[model samples]
Target chain A: MAQLFYAADLFGVAVFAITGALMAGRKSMDLFGVLVIAIITALGGGTLRDVILGNHPVSWIRDDTYILVASIAAVGTVVWVRLTQPIHEKGLLIADAFGLAVFTVYGTEVALQHELQLSTAVIMGVITGVAGGVMRDIICNEIPLIFKKEIYATACIAGALVFIALRALATPPWLDTGVAMLTVLATRLAAIRWHFSLPRFHLLDRD
Target chain B: MAQLFYAADLFGVAVFAITGALMAGRKSMDLFGVLVIAIITALGGGTLRDVILGNHPVSWIRDDTYILVASIAAVGTVVWVRLTQPIHEKGLLIADAFGLAVFTVYGTEVALQHELQLSTAVIMGVITGVAGGVMRDIICNEIPLIFKKEIYATACIAGALVFIALRALATPPWLDTGVAMLTVLATRLAAIRWHFSLPRFHLLDRD
Candidate 1:
């Protein structure tokens, strides 16, 4: 189980790094900027979770492998985009969804192991799933995609809730993880397909 | 010394919160959004600094007073803005400079106490001073003002180095703190007054 999670975590990091690098590319940022954004996107979410939970020696700082992987992924992205057609926007979104799913489940498990309240765990899960992208968008000078009338964070929230509910029912670990990931992925893809979004916050518009 | 630092920290939080709320007002964000941005701006810097250094129970988490001060300041800004003329942009910038000075010194103090390397301490100080504003700008969907060839972070870096230098030279605590804070405030205000900026990074402009 640990080995599976480790592999999935690295995969999530690579996908997130790719998204960040692509964003930097869109902005025509230089190589150093691209690498900075990529590492921040891949590591920001998990780092925030660990810090909030008071977990010492944040994962990447304690183990350099995560940093190495993110850097390689970022550079590879620049090379690929230069050599071939840019990644399709649709494909990018799908890849981001997978990263989100993996991150949310992994974050939830970490929070649960820390014996935090279920609600906090769910919040942490959503943060882990979406914060990197939020930071990426912010650094890229755009409103975060999650804050825009999107179903992105909502999908993570749904998955987190489902994961907690399943754990309550004493479901097997593999089944619980699988179901939770699918819940997030399906919701995200469905939202993408249908172009549905939550009601926008139009508070105080009567200026 | 500890008491003085505590008072200054709370004051810094309140000032930063006001700046955040004012920014949200300009964007016409809702009240909840205003509060969220305000709290984040006030606390984000220290939170990031502590997390990066592996400090536990982050300052605001360990003490509710920080949150309370930030909330009150945010709400007060809204009321003040609604009842009176909007704060002058110059006034706002000056206020932000003070906040920046206070946060930079306080963060460096914390890092020094942790016995980290001097370079790390300087980096942490700069992060603490500017990160909140960076976040505020990002959430408002704007390129961060500091990243735009401004001397913002540069001032923080200068102040951090001064603080470290003074401490090494066996300066008195009061003198060290005052000089460091003044270095940042003076440099920032001078930049604002003289309208000078660092050279712009035009890396990779070739299409």
Candidate 2:
């Protein structure tokens, strides 16, 4: 189970790197800029979570494998995109949905391991799921999609809530993780398919 | 000396809070939004530095005073702006400059005390100085001013370098800090006054 989770985590990192590199390409950034953005998009969320939790040395700094994987994924993205056509947008979104589900479940587990309060743990899970994409959009000078886009963060929150409830029922670890990830993936995919979004709250004042 | 530094740090927090509130006002955000942005702006850089350095509890979390000062300052700006004239843009810039200088020097000191390498210390100092503003701008969905504006980060780098150089020269603590702060302030003000800017870097490719 541990080995499977580790592999999925690396896959999530690579998926996020591809998304980041694609965004950088749109901005006409050079290869160095693309790599930097890709790495940040892949590792920024986990790094932020570990930092906030006071986990020392950060994950990537402690284990070089994470950085290596993100880098190779970014470079591979550039090569494939240049040699062929841009990745199909729908395919990219499906990949991202899976990545988000994996990270959200993994982050909740990490927070629970550190013995954080339930509410804090759920928040941390959502942050870990969405923060890398948030940072990517911010660096690219766009409002974070989570704020106004489809049910992105909401899906993460749902998954986190499910995880905590399952933990309370003392379910097996693998079953609990699998169920939570599926919850997130289903929520996100359904939102994507139905084109549904939460209503945006905006202040009403004439400029 | 410690008391003085503490007071200065709070003052810096207040300055950053005001800048954040002003930016929020420009975006026509409500009071709650303004306060959220202000708190993030005032404490974001320090929080990031502490987290990255594995300093537990974070500065604001450890000391409620930081959050209190930031909140009060943000509210004060709203009241002042609504009751009277808006703050002069130049005045706001100058206050931000001082805040940046203080944070940079303080961040460098914190990193050094943590026994980090000198180069890493310098990088931390610069990050601490400018990261809050970068975050503020990003949240507001704008390109960070440090990326293309006057010698903002350059000034921070200059101060960090000066701090390190003086430390090696065995300068007194007070002298080292005072001189470094002055260096940043002078460089930043000169840039603002002279309209000097670093050359913008852009890749040339026909779309």
Candidate 3:
């Protein structure tokens, strides 16, 4: 892989690590739990991608650098949050949005590299992006964001489409990746910012 | 792959479908819930196996036979229980044992065919065997079987070792699969029946 690709992968890992740490902070979990979530969030999506694609040594086991970086980032986030600007619940959401975008793009690229079909790659990307968070939430005894919200997978889906479009339009792969990343980030953030909600199925009571 | 393979898969589906339908029955749910769980239990493990393996068209989606058999069995079991026997919780442990064993063997074979090393193949098998139940329990707001007492993954690990050992001993592949299956079933059933528990640990608490 190019140095640029490696940089992007590491960047995504750091972003997710911080994001998981931030979520752990919100729950007021101990430092260990904070670190655990951070490690899981950073490693989770890529691990899924590798396992699904039958990539051996699994990705983290192959490189191990990613886990190292995530650990440092997670520990740093916790210390930084404690020492510097106090973090609020809303702050965690912002970090989470960034984390979500990174994983979605990262996962899509991994799937494409493995030569999955366009649609399957897209679906797998979304699954990789969301499944980890779903797991994090389940472990924490919270409802998964994907199952509860309107726009969770929607953002990943849109970003994946953009990715494919860019590729088809003969754009440079890196540029396409950037566009996909930004599109997901913007869509997800905008949805939350505007309090946008999709139609909900309602129930009627019998008299 | 083989006639016996298909039969084992079908048996796994049928048993688990009945198990799922029976659980939903205890919930006094509508027929929809019963059918959904039945399908989930019957199809869930293989669906996950294919997804993780990146095998397209999933198992049931490819052949359609598994789904049909599972649905018929599910409906049949629910009706039979409603008309005849009481819904005994005793059957759940037995059904779970059967499903776990069958899916584990099936997953191991699929991963091995994909040329994964024995360790990765075994991990895939265990994950495939357990993940569906974890998913089902999560959706139903129950703690996952993976987190429950009674040596779940340990049982699978042991059976997978038996499979590997037998194969290494030049046991006919078919016979190896049978031994593995029976080992898983026996181990899991014995664990449940004897109320066996693995020692739990929390790293923080340990210190």
Model number with the top TM-score: 3
Candidate 1, position A10, lDDT:
95
Query: Which residue runs does candidate 1 get wrong by more than 4 Å?
Result: A1-47, A56-133, A139-141, A145-207, B148-150, B197-207
Best by lDDT: 1
Among residues 3 or more apart in sequence or in different chains, the pairs in candidate 2 whose N, CA or C atoms overlap within 3 Å are: none
Cα lDDT, model 3, residue A162:
90
Give me the chain B TM-score of candidate 2.
0.94
- Candidate 3 per-residue lDDT, tens place, B1-207, comes to 488888888888888788778777776778888889888977887886676556777878778888898889888987798699886677887888899999888888777778766765676677668767766676677665655556677777777778877877988878999999999988888878897655432221110
Among incorrect, acceptable, medium and high, the docking class of model 2 is incorrect
Worst ten in a row by lDDT for model 1 chain A: A198-207
What DockQ does each listed candidate score?
Answer: 0.12, 0.14, 0.06
Q: Best DockQ goes to which candidate?
A: 2
lDDT ranking, high to low: 1, 2, 3
Instruction: Please state the error at residue A7 of candidate 2 in Å.
Output: 16
lDDT for each of the candidates? 0.84, 0.82, 0.75
